[model samples]
Structures are given as C-alpha cells and as structure tokens.
Target: MPWPSPPVVATGFPGAVAPVRVGRQGIYDRRRTLVAYELLFRNHGGASADLAEGAEQDHATSQVISATFGDFGVGQIAGDKPLFINLTRGFFTGELPIPFPPHQVVLELLENVEVDEEVMAGLRRLKDQGYRIAVDDFIGEPGRLPALGLADYVKIDVAAAGDAFDEVLALAREHSRDALVVVERIEDDALFARCLAAGADLFQGYGLQRPVTLEAVSLTPSQLVCLQLVRALTGTDVPIREIEDLVASDPALSLRVLKTVVSAATGTKNEITSLRQAIVMLGPQQLCSWVVLMLLGGVTGVDTESLTMVLARAAACARLAPAVADLAYTVGLLSGVASVLGMPEADLVDTTGVAGTVREALVQRHGPAGAALRAVLAYEEDEPCAITGTGHAVYEVSRAYLAALSDAMLTVGAVAGDS
Candidate 1:
C-alpha cells in the first residue's frame, strides 16, 4: 500500500489580508455534544452584509479557506473538533491542496457541485487521504446518490424532505450503513424529536431556538394583552404614569418587572416599593422592551432554553449597532415570532406598531438596524453576513453574544422566578 498524500492548498496572496475573524456553528450529535463546526466567512468592519454572491462569494470563500490554513491554522480555529468545510466545484477538482491534517477535515460537497469522473476521482483520493466527506443539502434516492460510497455523512434538508424523510433515511442507511445521517432545518422540539426517532445521527438549524410553524398558530389571551399594551405604548407617547398603571394592574407582569428590577438593582440601590418606581428605575423604554420580551416568550410557549437564546440574540444585535440598538433589540426579540406564532412577520410588526425602520429590517434587511439584526441572526446560524461598518469582527461579535447570554439568563431567570 502507498502512503496517503496530504491536502492540496493554494499559495497565499502575498498582500491579501483575510477578514479579522471567522464564524462557526456546531453540528451536534444525538447526545447534543458538538461533533464538528461548519465554518462561515465573515467580513471585518460592517461591509455589505449579504452572503457574497457570484464571483464575490467565490473569492470570499477562497479567502476564508486560504486564511484558515494561512494565518489562523485549523487547530486554533476548531480545537480538537473536526472542521466541516464547504468546497466549491472549482476547489473540489482543482490542484489546490487543503492545508489541514486529513483526519480533522470533512469536505462538504455543495449540493450543486458538478459531479463527474474527475470529481469522483477527487472524492476517492480525499477518502484515501483520511478526509471525511459530506454531501451538503443531499436529496436523492439511495441508488442514485452522488458521492454515496465515498461520503461519511449525508445532510438532508427536513423542509425539503417532507414526507420522504423516513424513506430517505432508510435508503441512506441501507446503502451506507456506517455513514451519519444529518438532518438540517429542523424547526422545533417536536420535529427534532421526530428526526431522532427516525434515526438521525446529527442535527442543525434554529428549530432548537424556537418553535417551527408547520401550521397556523393562535395567540393566547395573555399574549394578546401583551401585544396590545406594547402597541399602545409604542404607538403613542403615553404618560409614564399611565404606562405604570397598565403594568401595575397586571399582577404577573408587575411581579416580573419588580423582580427583574430588584434583582438587578441588588447592591446598587435602595428597595423599591411600587411598580411605578420600578418602571422609572428600569427606564421606561428598556422596561417596556423586557415586557415585550416576556410577551413574545409567553406567546411562543418557549422553554427556558429558547427564551434565553432569543434574548441573547437580541442583546447581541444591540451591541453590534449601538446607534440603533433599541430598534435592533426589538428586531432580535421578535425575529422568531413568525415561526412561533405562525403569523406573517409583517402582520406581527404591524400589530405591534414597531418602528417602520425596524419593520423594514425584519422584513427586508433595509437599514443599519436591519444590518445589525441580520448579523446577529447570521452568526446564530453560522452563515455569512454582509457586515457593513468599521472594526466589527468575529471576536467582538462573539464577545457580545456571550455577554448578552449572561445578562439575558439573569433577566429571564428573574422573570421566570417572579412569574
């Protein structure tokens, strides 16, 4: 037997500077333990915040790959975990070599990658080199599968699979007994459980972050009340006393507000006795935002885990664009409402009287607030973001999200305890 060859990597551009950082999202096994991280290219500073399309996308992706091997190195980026990297058709059959050790890399062949004799030969060579292979967004009968024999993983889009999931799973298993069956786009707990039941080996998507709206969803009375109050407050310049009265009348809402304020204010301030005082102390805008946060979670029937995730995402958006942070916060908090409530996002925004810019961002990613919100959402999904600004990088984005997670947990915990 001959010795296996190493990954083929391209030479670096002498003067080219890679982005300040890269973003990664984990692929979790059935045990909910991380097995791999899918790397995404992100720009430094706020640049255009869309996934680079056409030639730009190719260049951006190549830049990421080159930088991964060039400046950061695989070990520093992925630690001991395997890196699942996407390969464009060009990279797949080209002479460029992957710089990382074969055992630690998983070449993800894009669903649309051109597959032919050369591609097949490349796959064989990669397998021989000890690199795992995965077919991205795979959809095919077992007998007709591309890369079926060489692939170590087959990723299926649950939304696309629909009723064919069981059949697909069965076929994939029949053909590749040892390969992992990974399910993507799982939208909620129910579907996640269903995928697990169907013998899925790994999972992805925001399904764990919020409920997936398979059908129409109705709002409960408490949720309705929360929306109405938010609309009234945000739509008009309501007096602080009136706002305080509205919250004071709702014992559950009042209790949560008081608890959050009291808990947060612990050594810093004197005890508060009244809802009005608490409202003033929390700042009217921020306190109302928290109430809206509570309402959104209530409407969605979100578990603690889901609520925590939503709040952290919202806070991270605020951190990313401080000038429009308030609007960004609102956008982050309500971003998942559509999936949970089974309502059009536009309808929810209209009903809630969200600012036009916020609504625009939620719907179309139109403004600075929209850009910031998109960046946060993109990071969560481990996808590309068209960041447009100066000095924004993966390091700052990661720090903001982590900080928000801590703050959100404490806030949500207080509300949960009081409620």
Candidate 2:
C-alpha cells in the first residue's frame, strides 16, 4: 500500500490506493455483555511490512484511525460500545487532535509507551477531549505510576502473572480505584474462579466459551429441536406449521417472537398477540432470521462472546459473497455450534438437516461457500490469508468481517432488551 502523509480527517482523502483492514476481539463485563472491542489494525499493502519493522508505526496508526473514523465510520464497527485501540508512543504524542468521537474509542497505551512529561501532557489533552485511556498488559512498573494514575482500565495477563500477580493488582488498586481490572488468558475454570475471587472487574479469553470438553458429548433433546427448527426455516419448502410448533415448544422463544412482532410491526394497527399471527406477518425471510438468532442464543454452555463471534462471522461471510449469502451464514454459525454444544461438526450436519452444499462447506471446506468460510476464519485469526476463487481481495474480506461486528451487537442488543 502507498503511504501518504496523514490526512486531517479520516474521510474523503485523496491518496494512493491501498486496502485498509481491521479486526476486533470483544471485551465483556461480568455479566458477559459486550462493553468494548480491542481493534486490531493491518495495512494490506507493502507499507505495513515497514510498520512491522518499527519504521512506519505513525503511518500505519494514522491509516487505522482514518479507516475506522473516516472510511468506515465508528458506528459501522462499534455501535454503542467503546473501541479499545492500541496506541504507540508516536500516536500518543504526535497524532493529536483526533477527528473521531472520543466517547466511541478507548486508547490502550502499550506497556512500552513512555510515561514522561510530554506523554503525560498528551494524555491530559486526550482526557480533555473526553477519550478514555487503558494501560495494556500492565506489569506494575514503578516509573509508570503517572500513566497508571490516568488509566480508566488496566489489563493483566492471567497466564503469565506468576509471583507478581498480587503485586500488580495491589499497585493498580493503590494507583486508581476507578480503573477496571481486566484479566485476560483465563484458560480454565480454576483460573476464572481465581480471578473472580481476586476481584477482576472484567474477563476475556476463549476459555470462558470452551471451558471443558465433554468426553461423551452429544446434543440434548432441546438443542436438537433448536437445530431442527433452523433446518425447517431454511428449507426450500418452508415448514410453516413445524416452524411455528417448534418455536411454541419453548416458552421463552414464544415470548421473544411476540415481542419481535410487536416491536417490528410498521404499518399494522393492531398489536400481534400470538406466535401464529407473528409468524405470518414476519414472512418466511424475517422469520428465518429471528429463528437463527434465537437458536444461536439458546445454544447452551457457550459464553455470550463466542456466540456473538459466530453470528458476526456469518454476517461478514454473507456480505463477502451475496450470491450464496444464506448458505455462507449457516456454514459460519454451524462451524461453532458443534463446539458450543460439545458435539462434532459432522454430527451437526447429519442431525440438523443442513443442505448438502452447506454440509460440504462445514465438513470439508470445499466449493464456493467453503471458500468464503475459509476467508472469514482466516481473518478472525488476525493473520495473513488468501482465499482463492473468491474474486475479492483478502483485505476486502477483512473489512467485511470488521463491519459485521456492529450488526451482531445490534441484534444481540435487541434480544437482550426484549429479554
């Protein structure tokens, strides 16, 4: 990618063409509700290679800020929550007068970022502008006390916190009682419990979602019914009666259907009271969308973050390839559904009555739909990836995936409000 001088505003800049992409990992409150997301930045062009060598951090950081705030607005990536972004010392001091809304982003100062008079002054300026600051991977550096004092959040690595874990926590508490302590890499239940007992305000990691692998895992009767309901909704011949009956089988689901109909009803004068009427008014398309959301929500044993990622990836894949959008979505959702349910992906394919094309994509990752699925997964890994035959650049796929995070948040927010 061509590196041009930083623009004043992230929007409508006339510069050399280069694909800018971003990725995000959600940060959850104690209740597992998404409070923020840590933004991962990458420049798909050759300039980023120089960035990796520490020569072009300024240009790379500028592009990331511009892309999020200007190219794809903050509302498109993070709806109502703050975006946790990593900031170098250069961005802290040089990249001044931010153009994006301060409340929408949390600048995470890397551990190595200096805490000097100039840096502190920059931090003060950012504070004046209404932005929140977080100290990333804090390790209780005595010289960085001023930096710690300004932190709104302090992140600690649970896996690597050997003998100094308590010391770090003490220093953080002593410095700022207001700072939320976030413990990452809590890979198992024991560590999670330990962190909770030690008074962590927020937690993150794949462990919360995967927890323990059951030795003889199989789908329960209720879960089977949820999958079957999704199958019916997505089938060529919409099983309207079966779909309605399946939804009515669960009390919570029936109430959700009623609320959705009542809230989404645009022109109808009378309020929708029953599931049958709601189903008809919603139509097959809308009904299927709601069912898929409900089914994923009902998947037991998985944490909320993992479920959100699954849906977000599906939405992103759909946007990447609109021809087989629905199929791509199903592939993405089912990819994790088996793990969440403690069963195998193949078993889900056989049991859920998923279409043959979708099953092939899930089981083998072949065909056009599989090409899209591979691209989505690779982007989620936050690494370099190339999906052959997609006719779209990998960076474009990355952009789509980042955009999907907002959609997932909105859908989940609506469900939470109704509940």
Candidate 3:
C-alpha cells in the first residue's frame, strides 16, 4: 500500500530560509471575552519588543502577516476571531500589497503614519473593498483627526495617553460613532474597571494577557515558485493536471498536498495514490489556499530524521491497514506536524480543516485508523503489549515496520538528493 514517490524536480527559484516568529496579544470585550488579537513583531521567543524595534518596520509587519496566515495559520492562531494587524505607511498608502482577505483582518494604521489626503484616499479604497480600519495608539492629536472619520476601531494607549485617556476616549466615541474604542495598556484591575466603566469596547495590555511568541521554520522552495503555483491555481478554468504538475515539482509540497487532501476526505472509499487525484478532490480554491500559505509560511523545517520517521509511520499505517490506507496514512503523516512545530495536536487538526473520522483518529485515536496508528506508535516504542489491543499481531507489525523503514529512507534520500 506504499504510495509511489513523485520525481523531485528543482524549481530553480531562489528562496530564503530562516526561522520566523510573531507576537500575539489578546484583545477582550467589556465582559472580558476574547475577541481579537493584535499581532506584534518579535525578534525572539521573549516577551520583550526591544529586538523588534531595531528591525525595519515594514519588514516586521510583513513577517507578522506571513507568519500569522502562512506559517502558524489564522485558524490555529485566532480561530474564528479577526486579527488586528498594524500597517505601516507602505501598506496604508497602498505602496505595498496586503495579501490577506479583508474579512480576516482589521487593518491598523499605526500612530506614526502621516494621514494625508493621499493616505485617506487609500483608506477609502480599502474601506470600499470591505476592510475594517483601526487607528492605533490614538491620543486625540489634531494631525490624526482626519483618519477618525473612516475608523472602525480607535485604539488608545492608556499609559501613553495618561490624563488625556478619558478625553481621547470621548473624542473617539464622538468622531467615529460606529468605531469600537479599544483601550490598550490596562496594567491593573483598577484600570480595567475604569476602562470598562468608560465604555471601552475592547481591552489589551500586559496585565490582561502578555504577548506569546510563535516561531516556525521556513520551507526550502523559492517563494517565486510557490507564488507562481498559487497564481495558476487561482486563475479561471485551470486544468487539474496543470496544478498537479506544478505541485509534483517539489517533494515537500507534494507530501503536504497529499496528506491534507487524504486527511480531509475521511469518508472517501477510493485510495488517493496520485497528485492529480488529490488536486481534483481538493478543488482549485482550497489547493490555491494551501499554496498561498506555503508561499507565505514556506515549508516546515522538519529535520531529515523527523521527516523520515513521519513517512515511515505513514507507510507502516498503510501497510497495516489496507482497507483504510488513505486515512491511516494521513493520520500517521500529520501525527508528527505538531511535534515539529511545537503546537498542540488539536490546534493543528483544526488549522488544517481535518474533520469527522479523520479528526477523531488524529485527536482521540478512535476507530480502526486510530488503532492502526496506535499499533504503529506502540511498535515504534517496542511495547508489544500495547500493540495487542490494537488487533494487529506483533509479527505482522514488525514486518510492516521494517519495510516501511526501508521505503521511508529511500523517499527521504530522494527528497534530499542523496538517492
């Protein structure tokens, strides 16, 4: 039941490889319910923003957007909640492109941005396209008065605003009747109560919840190739074989595409052995989303050993459970993603849209697919007793494991250009 490996083709596109990180801080409503997160730029795993201050603002903003939507995934980071991302002059003035859909994010215009007629015109255009604009770190400055009229959310820094906080809050309420006044830097219980009493719509600060730093390894393929594939997939009436051919060019992309499609198709009876089947089943829009994410996040930085183990587990699952090889393979492949990314397994499943029986197998290890995964895991740990309850004999499991190991090594070698 081992799936055939696609030929590894070099895209000849230059790509940057490095670790990416972003900071996330929750913004709560009056009742203290988490509503949105203000994504920040972080240079390291620490909570301090010092390192991020030294980096170019535009680069930092780009990193945050890419890391949130691309690497960590919006679903995994914020679930159904909208993200509040700070926009520099480049983004606000339309000098740079915002890759995300308007509905998924609230565009925050930083306090430093010069809000002129040109910028206001850009804001109007974005608003017309359904983007919600937020005026960040507002202090009722006369210079920024023009932006308040188009603002959907007006954020005020309590610590920075000092005594003007109340006045600015009132001004925000008066200028933008529909805007949600977000009070930031609420450092104490007293401050939180004060902001709540002042009719603040949302609250954020270190006292409420400190920012958490999230990091991920960049993929090896060039951004150009990933973007090219994304553009092709997004184009009208594109052939399925064309998209499949583009995906088959990269081994890592092919692996993820197959795993995602098979995992989501939990009820399908047919075995998805080729990239074309996966592309056809996933559809162009979904596949395009995956490629865009890959373009933004790059590939996972799973080491050779970790990737080989994941492939081996997938191969073993397929061999042990031929009746549901696709589902088993998906479970086995995705089982290592969380470990590699240092995220919760449930979060990974939710992020990837893995649902129904596949979700149960990955999260709770239920059913035959789960049993197969459990048996493989137990065999890996040399726990013969644990494998007994999985309805798989030790001898058969041993043979499957050995064969899968050999197959996995060859696959890994091929991907690594060692074969």
lDDT of 3 by residue, 1-419 (tens): 54233223222222323566888899999888898998888875555454233126766676676666545667667877888998788777766666656766899998888899889999999999889999999998989988999999999999998988889988888889999999999888899998899889999998789888877653344344466687887688888767754564443455456555644333467655444566787777666665654554434332456556656777788788888876777677666445444557687666555446767877798877788888888887767889888999877887887798788777566555531
- Candidate 2: deviation at residue 349, Å? 37
lDDT of 2 by residue, 313-360 (tens): 667777876777656665666664454445577875554333566668
Give each model a TM-score: 0.43, 0.44, 0.62
Alpha-carbon runs more than 4 Å astray in model 1: 1-18, 43-57, 141-144, 208-419
Off by over 4 Å in 2: 1-18, 43-54, 95-97, 208-419
lDDT winner among the candidates?
3
Worst 10 residues of 3 by lDDT: 5-14
Ranking by TM-score: 3, 2, 1
Clash count (model 2, backbone only) = 2
TM-score, candidate 1, is: 0.43
- Per-residue CA lDDT of model 1 for 1-419, tens digit only, reads 32222112112211111223456667788877767777766555543225544455455555455444433445546677877777766556754434344656788887766678888888888788778988887666443375776789988888888898888788777766788988988777798899999899998876543211111122221343356567767766778867754553332344345444533332444544334566677665556555454442323222445445656766777788887765566566556434433457686554343345666877887776677766666556554333323235655666677787788677557545544
For each of the candidates, give the backbone clash count. 15, 2, 1
**Overall local distance difference test of candidate 3:** 0.71
- Over 4 Å off in model 3, which ranges? 1-22, 28-35, 50-59, 62-82, 89-104, 116-122, 141-143, 163-167, 189-200, 212-238, 241-329, 335-353, 359-419
lDDT of 3 at 204: 98
**Alpha-carbon shift of residue 171 in model 1 (angstroms):** 2.4
Name the lDDT of candidate 2: 0.60
Query: Highest TM-score: which candidate?
Result: 3
RMSD each, Å: 25.9, 21.5, 7.8
